[model samples]
Target: MEIDLAGYDGVIVSPGVPLNRHPIAAHARAAGVPVIGDIELFAQARSELPAHKVVGITGTNGKSTTTALIHHILKTAGVPTLMGGNIGLPILSRDPLPEGGVYVLELSSYQIDLTFSLDCDVAVLTNITPDHLDRYDGLEGYAASKARLFAMQSPDHVALVDFQAEADHAVLDMAPDGLGCLFLDDVPVEGQENWPALQGPHNRQNAACAIATCRILGLEDDAIEQGLRTYPGLPHRMERVAEKDGVLFVNDSKATNATATAPALAAYPLIHWILGGRPKTDDLDDCAPHFDHVVAGYTIGEAGPMFARILKDAGKTVTESGTLRQAVRDAAAAAKPGEVVMLSPACASFDQFTDYEARGEAFRAAVEAL
Candidate 1:
């Protein structure tokens, strides 16, 4: 099948399409048609919509949680809001938000590549890590794409960035006028222990970003605090599924790399960790600091044997379950009171499931069957 770009002004493609290698990119280039994505279309339509603001969040991890947190806080404060771009419904397909509405978008690097002029009222870079390297030139290229979010923002607009890592600093460097000056410490997020859904250092950072953005938008402390307390967490990312015989089950299937999975391991104690899918990294060095939390590890999917050996060598008890259902059964059977059976696979889900959501659903079903 051939796609003719005879009279088309541009070719719209999914963010997952790789412009560096895809045939559509070449065809579009040959036809002198600009290759764009939904985000770009949304950007072009913003002038015709009602009065609104946009918050754009992008990072290697934690962006979904942060995006949802902001939207939840806005809704709680009685502001009209919609979350899209990466975490929710398509931006263009949805109806125009009413006046004073905020569009909180979770952006990826690929989407950023195609979006030329999305001037967010509040732009956030959660954190930059080495993931999705195949889509860009290298880690630097990926970081640059994330930085473009801040670059697109007007100087009067707020840019909230996490300057924790060297790569994050690099992202700031690439941005216009070094806008990545805001830190989590700059804003005080008190009483985090009272927030049930937000736990661990990662969530704390996410909370800081949300709090900062809300404050910039004129939300008071009381409203932000209430929103934080009542905000329910998203699925496939540290969601509590069920409990049986005093053993809790957690689904963190969205932790598709070691950096994302490390915090989940640190959040709990006596964990019967079920991990392994299509391999991302050869070694789990980022997760090494939290290895003591694992009571035992169940290896499954494409990376099972290698992960089993790695865990064994680390002096941790290892079970080569090779499948999600078997791993859940073994972990559940072995888990005792006060222990957790958590699925925080630090790899892609293509080997055994359609996506991370499917993997998380399978974890829930297996837990329910018990």
Candidate 2:
């Protein structure tokens, strides 16, 4: 990681690099070289690529789904599109799209912090919540980082923000005039019921944001609807893995935190909720409202005992299963007809698995085994 920063325009780093404390950032700063991310690199190269619109989506949760959904809609309408940024591939790694194409990017707050000049044609803020507190000053600082995506856009461009879950009005203030406010309830329930991948109130907002972004991109309603109906959905985020004897198995391993897991819990009525992992927060305050939806809880990984105690205190039946496989088996065995055996752990998978994707694959494998 040692290199002279002479004659370099800027040091490009991944979103995970904490510029606030990383020595690389300090070295780059001392060398008078700015540290930027892939999104900024893509912004600089935009003029070289053929005429194409960019959609930048940022928030604590649902950004990935919204980004993928928008990409799916554009493709469904026969428009050439590529999804990158914080989701799949780095923006600079992918081949440039042809004319009339759209680049849908799921930007994290960290990426947005390092990105300076990405003026997205359509920018969406799904919703803001407390996350990555160690990276920024606090929740306000984190929210400000997300707000920069819209601030980088032009006045003529469209900015879509989810007003329903917006914790700070200041984020809306940072948006350009003629802002498009998306409310989850505004998205017709009947329309969403048909979208299997996009279930739960949170996905409703994700769908709403995608719909607004697609409409701004000049997509017809029919094409947008078709895309919503046919979005295969991203892995580990509300993915319907399998079904056994009328019991559905869902893999929501990307939750990683209670804020992300809360919506997944709300998606199913009778859930044998399997949760826990490397602990992020001591309390599941965000998920408390949906306690009634859980038929019982199976806890595992580092936070197993803690979550078991919490669920028990909340008057919900709890199983202190110490492993993902055991939690799956316990939930599956206890699950009755018309119940959902969901793996929506509200913590990171580092305690037992390499990452959330690996945890999700394990959940899928465990369900397949059943």
Candidate 3:
């Protein structure tokens, strides 16, 4: 719906709204209304309020969990904080903060594209990967969009980067040379041993980024540790769905690409992996390194046959389970003791479901039935 924000403060929209390709951009431009994202709206509203802070997080993955962890830490320390943007409620929908509140925003590339003047107190880039490439022209264009978050900030802002790969390195290499960039590799990953939910190398990177962000925000070390220990992981993203008959069921439906799903595959061994959907890119070659972990593959959705062919050629056992329900049942039946039935579809969900959440729910329900 087109909003008449004339004389009103501003209009807040879902980060998924493609302003560059959507009518909202033209309408807002014609109305002289600055096309600000939810994060920008939150930043603007914070001005009239008491002393509040914002931590903006953007990356190809781990954004939701990192944002939640930051908010969890702040709340554990008795600081009022809200987690919003791509993680939870729309930023503008929340009631105004009273005083000394913190806003942890999980920003997507589209949101960052719309946001121009938002100066986050703590800005973070988890890692950049080949994602949403159709929206941008190529990988460089996509990285450029992610880079805009740090660019919009002032020299005083702090950036947490998880330089995962050469692509991430290339993105960080263009960081204006003098910006305050905290590399996750430089952070000590030792303290996170106490946090089980934050397991795996990806979560370690996430923990390091969150710790750096909280530390930059002046959060005490004790409080940060407490938050890390108590933080519950986000749903549908590396969530432990069920364990039946000695087999573990992992619902990493949020992994819509090879880079995102690769970490989960690396986390486990002997996986009866359920993958395939509306394929994101041409190849799953990035995930090939983890092929030793996959004992059998259950393919589903539009890319089922294609993935089956790919796996078959790779000498991996494969089944073209056309639906999520069938895929789950087949994988469950085929899985043995000490094996993992993981739903890490390295593709988008639009082929058979509204989104990844629905696809994940369907996987859970199917798993429950088995």
Candidate 2 per-residue C-alpha lDDT over 289-330 given as tens digits, one digit per residue, 9 for 90 to 100: 999999999999999999999999999999898998998899
Candidate 1 ranges with C-alpha deviation above 4 Å: 1-9, 23-33, 165-170, 173-181
Ranking by TM-score: 2, 1, 3
Lowest lDDT sum, 10 consecutive residues, model 1, at 165-174
RMSD to the true structure for each prediction, in A, is 2.9, 2.7, 3.9
For every model shown, what is its TM-score relative to the native structure?
0.88, 0.90, 0.82
Instruction: Report lDDT per candidate.
Output: 0.89, 0.87, 0.82
The residue-by-residue lDDT of candidate 1 on 258-359, one tens digit each, is 878999998887899999999989999999999999999999998999999999999999999989999999999899999999999999999999999999
Writing each residue's lDDT as its tens digit, candidate 3 over 338-367 gives 998999999999999999999999988988
Better of 1 and 2 by TM-score: 2
Model 2: worst 10 consecutive residues (lDDT sum): 181-190
* Alpha carbon lDDT at 322, candidate 1: 89
Instruction: Please report the candidate that would top TM-score against the real structure.
Output: 2
- Considering lDDT, which of the candidate structures 1 and 3 is the better prediction for this target? 1
